[model samples]
Target: MQYRTNPDYWNQWYPSDLISESFPGQFRNWFYSLLVMATVLDNSPPFKANFTYGTLVAEDGRAMHKSWGNSIEFNKAADKMGVDVMRWMYCNHKSENNLFFGYNRADEVRRQFLLPLWNAYKFLVNYAILDDWTPNGETLPILDNVLDTWIISRLNQVIDKVNTLIQNYDPFNATLVVESFINDLTNWYIRRSRRRFWRSEQDNDKKHAYAVLYHVITTLTRLLAPITPFVTEVMYQNLVHSNNPPQHIPFEGEGQGVMSHESVHHCEYPKADLSLVNDDILDQMSVARQVCSLGLSARNQAGLKVRQPLSKILVHMGDYHTELKPEFVQIILDELNVKQFEIVSKVESLVAYQVLPNNKILGPKFGRQFPKIRQALVVADHAEIVKKVNNGESISLDIDGESVVIYPDEVVIQTKPIEGLAVGADKHMTVGIDTIITDELATEGMSRELVRHIQALRKEAGFNIEDRITVYYQTDGDIANVFDTWTDYIKEETLTNELVSGTHAEEIFTKSVKIGKHEVMFGLKKI
Candidate 1:
C-alpha cells in the first residue's frame, strides 16, 4: 500500500530513512524479506538513507544474556541511572562501532558530565534564589568582562557546530560538541564568574553574568531535548516556566524560545547567531587554557599543588599562539595559583637544549659522513634546531659551509634545568615553576590549606553558603603564625565572623589534620 499507485497519499509510508538492528544475517533475514516483497511487487528500493547501528556488548566485550548473568534490562538501567545518562551514552557513540554499554560506563558518564552539569545548574538556582533574581525574558546584555563575552561566543559556536552535524544525521559528533559546551559552562564560565553571583551588589555586571548563564543553559537544554527529554524538561520547567513565561524570545529560523508552552519539548530548537561567534576570542581563550595547563603541569612536576603559591611561572613562547595579554595572564595566575608569570619570547631563554642524533637511523643514512652529521648536530644552533624538531619541521644545519637537513625523527632533544626550576613543555607551550618557596609563600599556602579544610567542614556541617561562622583552631607555634599572618584572608574566604585560636565546644564540626610535623585542629560554628 505504501508504494501503491493512487491519486491520494501514494508512497505515504515510504521511508525517507531506514534504521534497524544490524546483527549478523539481518540483511538476509529482515531486509531480505522486504527485498523479496518489493521485487515481486515491482517496487524500487525505498529508503533515501540507511543507517545501520552496531550491537551493544558488555564493557569487557561479553555479549549480554540472562544465562551469562551479564544482561541488563533497559527499563531497570534507565530507572537506576537516568534516561538522560542512557540517552547521552546512546548519542555519544558512532553508529559503526559497538557501544560498550553497562552500569560501569553509566557511572563514568554520570560522574564526568551529568554531575558537573547539575552542579552548574544548582549553583545558578541557589544563588539566584538568594539574590531574588527573576528572569525578565531579557536577552543577553553586553558586558565588558572577557569571560562573559567568551562564554556567549563559545555557546553560539557550539550551537552552530552541533546543529550542522545533527542536520547531516550525525548525532555522535553533535553530542560530543554539547558535552564540551557543558564543560565550558561548568568549569570555565560558572567557576570564573562565581564571585559575581555571590557578591552583595546587584550591579549590571552581576545581572549580565546571570543572564548569560541563563541564555546558555536554556539554549543548551533546547538542543538536547530531542535526545534526552526528561532532565531538560525538569530544568526548563523550574528555570523558565517557574521563573517567567508568556514572553517571546525570537530565535533564528522557526526556532523561538517558548512564549506559550510549558514543556521544553514544546519549544522550538535554539538557533545559532553566527554573528556572536568570534574565533579571535576563542583562540585567545584557548591560549589562556594552554598556559594554565602548562603551568599546572610545571607545578605537578615541582611537587606543588595549585593551593601552593609559587612566586612565578616562566612561559616559553612559541609562534603557535598570539601574545598573552595582561587579562589572559591574570586568568592564568588565578587558575594555576601562581603569583606572577615571566613569559620569554625565546625558548632558548628557558631551556638549554641538547640535541643527539639517532645513530641507528642516521648511521646507515649518512654512511662515512655520519661523524660530520654528529658534529653538525653538536655545534649547530641547538636552540633553533630543537625548536624546528619540536615543531615537527626539518632542521637545517650548516656544517663547514655544507648544508644538511635533519628531520625530526633523526634527533632526540633534551632540556637542561634552569636554576633547578620544575619545567614542563608540550609542542606549543613550555612553562617552568619556580621551586623556591619563600617563607611568605609557604605561609600563604598553609593559610589556603586551612581555608580549604574550613570550607569542607562547613559543607559537612550543613551550614548555608551565606552563613557566617567562627573558625576555631589549635595548632603549633609555626602554624599559629601563619593563621595570624593571613587571618583576614582566611576569614573572608570562609565567611568567618572571627578566627579563634582556642578550641570551641564539642558540638561544633571539628577535625584534626597534619601539616608536615604539626597537628592542627579546625572547628566551625555557625553564627
Candidate 2:
C-alpha cells in the first residue's frame, strides 16, 4: 500500500564520488536536502503512486494516549465477548463515521438481538419436544391464518430490505432491520401464537403455526449467521438439526426442509420471496396499530386502566385517513378492551370549535383593523366558523359598510372535547374514549384483575405455567358478586377445575388479595 518514487535516481545520484565531493561539513547537509527534493521531482521512470492522510484516533474517536487511559487493548476487548461480537459491532458502523466502542454498546447487541434470537430458538425447541413434533418438510398453507400470512409477509420484506442494504455496503442499517424483525418475531408473532403450541391436541392450525415458526426461526438464523456465527450456530443446531434427521434431505419443490447443515455459518444467505410480501396488508396493519395506540393514549387521559374495558371507541380519520378492514378494527378493539369501535366521518358533532384571529396573518394585513377583526372573531358563531373552515371557505365581516374578508388561514381553530369523553388526536386521526363504566364492565374488569393476581400468585407459589388447580376465595361486598358473574372466565383463565367461595381451611398457600375496596382470602390447590 505504500509507494515511493524511483530508487534508481537515488542510486545514480548517490554514487561514492559525488557523496565524497559534497561530504564536507555543512555542505553534506545541503546536498542531502536537495537529493530528497530530487526524488519527488524525479518521475522520469514513470512509476505510479498515490497517498492518503487522516488523523489516527482510538475507537472512541479520541486521540489515543496511555496517559489519558482512552486506549483500548485489542485482546482485552476480544476477551469480553469474544471477537465475534466486537467484529459484528465494528462492521455495523458506517465507515465514514468514527466508531465509539463501549461495553454498553456490546451489551445492547446481546440484549436487543442475540438474546431474543436465542430465546426464540429455545422456546420453539422446548415446545416442539413437548408436542412431539418433527419437521416432515410439510408445506404448510400460508392462507391457514391471518397471523401466518402477516408473519410470512413481514419476513419476506425484511429479507428484501436486508439483502439490498448489505449489497450496498450498509451493514449498519441491515443489522438494525434484523434487530427490529427479531423484536416483532418475539413480541408479536410468538406471543400471539403461544396458545396454539399450548393446545392439547396437535390440530391442523397448531401444526401450521409450528411450521411457520420453525421456518421463520431457521431463516432468520441463516440471515444473521454471517454477522453472528456462534450464537446462530447454536440456535440452528437446537431448533433445526436436533429434530431433523439425517435422512431428511427434503423433497424438491416441497416446503423448505430442516437444515441438516452442521453449523449456521455454512448455510447460504436467504433470498427474499416477493410473492409473500404484501405491502397493502402491512400498511393496513400499521394504521390499525396507530388507532390502538391513540386509543390507549386516550384511555390514559381518562384515568382508565386497560383491565377496565370501555364500552366504545370513536376513531376520526383526519386528512391522511386509512380505511381499516373489519379484522384490523377487531385488533384495535381487543387491544383496547372496548366492546365496540366506530369510525367517525365527520367531527362537527364530535368536537366543539373555538375561533381566534391569527394575529400573525391579520396584524400586518389590516394593521389598525386587526382589533376589529379579533372582536368579530370572538363574537362570531364559532360553530358557523368551524363549518366554513371545514368546508375550506373564508369568513366575511362588515365594519361601517366596508366589507372585509378573512381566509381560514387567518384564524386558528381549536377543538374542545365533549363532556365525559377523553379525546386524543394527532394529524393522522382523533381517538375518543367513553370513560363511563357500567356494572357489567366493572365485573369483567375485576374478573380480569383477579385472574392476573392469581397468575402472579401461581408463579410465586412455584407452580408451572400449565399447572391446573382448585380455587378457594372468601370475600364480602360486590367482589363476591363479580366472582359469581365471571366464574367461568376466571376458571378458564386460571386453569381452575373447582371454585369455592364460602370458606377454606388455613394453609401455607392461602394469601389475602386486594380486589377493589375489599380484601379477599384466596388459595390455590393442585387438582
Model 1 regions more than 4 Å off: 2-8, 11-25, 29-45, 247-260, 364-368, 396-404, 505-507
Per residue, candidate 2 scores C-alpha lDDT tens digits across 326-413 of 8777778877899998978766545677899888889999989889888888887886777677778888887657888989888998
lDDT per residue (tens digit) for residues 368-462 in model 1: 98999998888878877876886789887776688888799999887886875888888777788788999989999998988888888899889
TM-score of 1: 0.91
**TM-score per candidate, chains pooled:** 0.91, 0.78
Error of 2 at 478 (Å): 1.8
Q: Which is the leading candidate under TM-score?
A: 1
RMSD of each: 2.8, 9.6
- Position 446, candidate 1: lDDT: 91
The alpha-carbon deviation from the true structure for residue 402 of candidate 1, after best TM-score superposition, in angstroms, is: 4.4
